[model samples]
Target: MATRLQSKWFRDNSRLQHCLVSDPHHVLRGATGEHVSLIQGALSILDGSRIADDEQKRHLYGPTTENAVLEYKKRRRIINLLYQTQADAIVGKMTIRRLDEEMKAQERSRSHLMFAVGVSLPEPRMVILSETANRDFVGWANQMVKLYSGKVVKVDAATDPAEEVKRIRQAVNTAGAGGLLILSVGHGVCIPQFGEQGTFDLAPNAAMRVLGKNYNENEPKDFVSPYYDDKPAANTGLKPLSQKDKDERDQTPGAQRRLKNWALWQEVCKIFVDGKLSAVVLLTCRIGGAPLFLQKIAGQWRTKMIAYKDQVGCYQTASGRFRTILGKDKDKTAPPPPPHTNTPWGEITIPLSMTDMVVIDPPAAPKTP
Candidate 1:
């Protein structure tokens, strides 16, 4: 049923061409004679290749040809299976120019891609930071990409946080998605920056742009503050980093200059305001209850930012210790495991609060014309 042009596309890609000709019955009637010659050519190519003996050669090539034939029988449901299979070969070729333009024109105007700069610890060492955590985060992130139209890239555990943030911002800007998401986790410190007039609290502002007026402004002046009450609304018990911890943190490789948790959190807020992000989620302690100056944005109070002070340990430790806890249950049948689970570390769901931001949008509406 393929048109002449479509059949030609399949023939151009060697692997897909081989697959198409593997089964005589599935190929177009017009290509039958060519298909026979193709088979002869393949046999000739194999004749000179590295095959120890007739028996081994026959065993390998025989099943490969047979499997291809069987698989093609079911591939006919595809509207343009040949074209889809050959898309890569013809990507830069003239054949797809019109189709490619039309496809780009139809894409959503909003950007779906987001980027996050995550830190496991202040110094990138001490405490418990592992490759296992990065792998786990990447796996969950890929699932999120599948749910959404755009991709999500993470920069974490970088040797240089400032440079890493710069690269991430550039990539996301190039992607031009509707919104962005940024998450940073590590030790939160409060420190003073020496200035012309007086000392100012230094916030996290390396390689950050778009949260305030111009791109690359480091001051944390424009933002909103959430009022922390005695009652536990989101249950994140946030507290300021003590002076002792701040001094110790300053000695860390990346923390030579003292940085406050509030300042670091504000960079996330800028993403939403700069039209680069629809939502931003911070997975650190004391982010929600930051001081008034740090929290005020555009002369209004902004409180949606959720911060769980000292809760990262809870999530990681809970899942890490799941094996022990489940064993203690002593019940015979275990419940179903969480998605993409580490056998030892049960399934992970971003805390209920952050799940809303992670959900993917549904596919488009059918053509109504």
Candidate 2:
């Protein structure tokens, strides 16, 4: 396992270094059996570029060279040695200096260190009410954030929710790191905005009603522009549009705009809609907790935890799964009797690496009708 991990790490680092500074000729001659074809293709491309110094090119890609020779031998394929000898004879010394320069030009693009900040939920009521749940979130988040010098702001848990959200949003926008990691862990529910449920329909006039011709963020007082530009005289109770039309209107700019409510789902949704997040890990038990903001960019990667019971606490099968939860108590005491209440409980899950295990209570599931 250690050997495999080390090799994987080396390969990953090599790939990273390649992205940072790649030699075009080194790239041109990559495989063992494909040497002839690769060389022909490279020469065709290089010939067009007017690359001078044939000897340098030979050393760069020719079969007699160390890299090409090794690559050829690795494939267990031996071909015309006369062609190799002929190329070696005509080629001069002195490796190409321009390819090295080109490689150096791409150095800045190969950064691996990443920084991210994640928030479970920005609402105060939900976090404070669920203390154990909050601990789980804090423990898991702090562990992950330590890798990147990042911070996790518990909005509802904090003294001032508004101030915390503001600070968090600012940090997220200015992190200036490789990628921003954002998590919105909480319950999710859809609301009827203009009587539409998950409707994607939008019209030009409805769009204008929601977003306006020239929307300005500078106008703090005029935060939400009125749905209607002009109201009819006196007894005119004529609605602006049908519920379906109004739904379309609400869906337009409101879909992109900052949410009006401070719901847990909305807080998580705000992070994605704000448009600074690179990767988001939703810890909510249910799907569709947060909209897919960076979905296509990251594809299908996710942080999933599966729990199983052991002697004391539950254990996760994946490596380093329960490490965060298995912490040493300052004063370890004898285990207390299990709760007497008829609580449908689950065991505490810890990683397999740890020696000690402890029991913990999970948040009670809501009773179904």
Candidate 3:
């Protein structure tokens, strides 16, 4: 197993000076003493009887050193193959430069640092009722946010969806771009528009309405009635509305309203269109499975999206799955778990291209020991 090291350790190349090839004349082949030892140590190839036979302290240009150099040359050839270039067995400035480049690449690959934004269904909308479930979801979301170095922006249920979107946009703008926006909502529904073939419409506050149905056995209650009946003309049961009454009713100011999914999608696109956001992950129930819906937004925004391809269960299940992906804490001694599984509860990545939706299936369950 490869031990993880700090980035600074690799960034500082001074430690490699002793092992680095200095003299142009002192090459690996037919080189005796410290030269052979230094080259072998630099490449981390400790596989020879001569290397273990340290009692003599004699660095002889033996078969062991030659074999190590040969192996190193072969590795370089493999790298050259990738670039469609001819490979030479000799090590020189070119080889040292490639090694340095590889170290820098390693440093980048090991960096888990990131910045992110987390958005979740607020208050009444997230009526899971179970405190444990809610806590687990919040914890899991926070864990992911921390893993990516993000901050959570709470959106209250009382706030209009449009206003929430505006706030999020402002936050992204203020934070200065190139991060993630993670949205955890309820079930996603597609409403068809009359003339729009690929576009889907949505009723105001659709997430609350749809999610409420899952939480309650009774009919989903509304924050306010869609119809307005507070006017004085209603006293006359069958009377026609006067122009003045109509104007007054139209002028009457009401509460701010939530936007439909299409409107929400538009708002999201506006924020991410300039490549400000590298990725978006919708942690909702069924949005991942909606290919048409996902394709419509992904195609327009050109941002990658990670979402579930099936109905993600309650917060508990969602959190559990996230923990599994991030790795379990208990049994750190055990081998690392596979990233993918065969379960229906897998994450799918919708790329910028409409045709290339990649599904990462879950790995099979481990057999009993």
Candidate 4:
């Protein structure tokens, strides 16, 4: 089951420059270093454009990387079955060796949808984050959009959410037909009351301007989502929120914003005139932990979701394998596979399509007129 991918980037074309470590030393998700680069490099050569960046030297295991791992494991049936029932997507002994097996040969090519669309609009007031401070994410998003979103449409996620929705609908219409894919980038947040309905912060700052600064900012709402399953899973330690818990979180800021985004998705969902958009990729962090939230949001968009369940960041050391300029990774060429999967925590989850979130270095941004 070796991947059909063929590339010279793979070391010697028979084996990776670095080996995928065994258990304990296994490279799970949330990892960053040279070892990760090795894994990403191999996958890139083995899987074609599937990795986020074809030459992902950043070496951070984000959603795209995690999904690739899951896909690789699934295709090769690398599950041990002794410990876990299904492919967990974590890069342990079995997973790595399986990926290694494909390093030696070349075969068919995998076709992917490079036409996904991305929509990101943070509060207009928020400054463009130091592009370097969040380079890993910025780069990931930039690359993912570039590689997968062959047809790019420009929309500001304008301060007026309603307008943003209108613009997105227009993008979908003009982008042509087929499975529609979208990337929602920016801050992701969760209210304990709706922990399972985790939402993003794309609301305009104008909505928050009138709210008092000293008021209870952590209070919860009575909000309930149709797709949210409050019942805890049979054995998962996770529990439902009590009234006290909800009260504590209701005062939080951004509730309206999250709600607005929720409504916005409803509108976005309705825009599926041709077919369900391939998937709504959430480039935000930690949303994957809330499966129910994903379900609800996806339901709103009438599509599946791909999201992460952790604080997505790559490491940067003065002498680290992945160096940074100012703060961004110095090397801007490369792609990655998807991630450390969901255990008590989570990896990027693709409810339907298990693997398709690779990220290669994106072409430079176009000059704005």
Q: Which is the leading candidate under TM-score? A: 4
> Order of all candidates by lDDT, from best down to worst?
4, 3, 1, 2
Expressed as tens digits, the lDDT of each residue in 113-216 for candidate 1 is 21111111111111111112444444444443443323344443332345433443443343333333335433222122311111111123322211211211
Alpha-carbon runs more than 4 Å astray in model 1: 1-133, 146-157, 171-178, 184-276, 289-304, 313-349, 353-369
**Model 4 lDDT tens row, 301-321:** 455565555433333323222
Q: Which regions of candidate 3 deviate over 4 angstroms?
A: 1-133, 148-159, 174-176, 189-269, 299-302, 313-369
How well does each candidate superpose onto the true structure, as a TM-score? 0.29, 0.28, 0.36, 0.41
Worst 10 residues of 4 by lDDT: 342-351
Q: lDDT per residue, candidate 2, 157-269, as tens digits?
A: 22233444444455444432223333322322222221111111011111111122122323322222221132335455676542224434565554333233113223433
Query: Which residue runs of candidate 4 sit more than 4 Å off their true CA positions?
Result: 1-155, 174-180, 191-195, 202-265, 272-275, 313-369
Clashes of 3: 8
Q: What TM-score does prediction 3 earn? A: 0.36
Q: List clashing residue pairs in candidate 2.
A: 55-92, 124-156, 314-348, 322-351
Give the Å error, residue 101, model 1: 35
| TM-score, candidate number 4 | 0.41
Better of 1 and 2 by lDDT: 1
User: Candidate 2, which ten residues in sequence have the lowest lDDT sum?
Assistant: 340-349
Task: Give lDDT tens digits, candidate 3, residues 85-195.
Answer: 654444444444444455445324432112111121121011101112245445554443444332334332213456555655654453344454445433343223311
State model 3's lDDT. Answer: 0.36
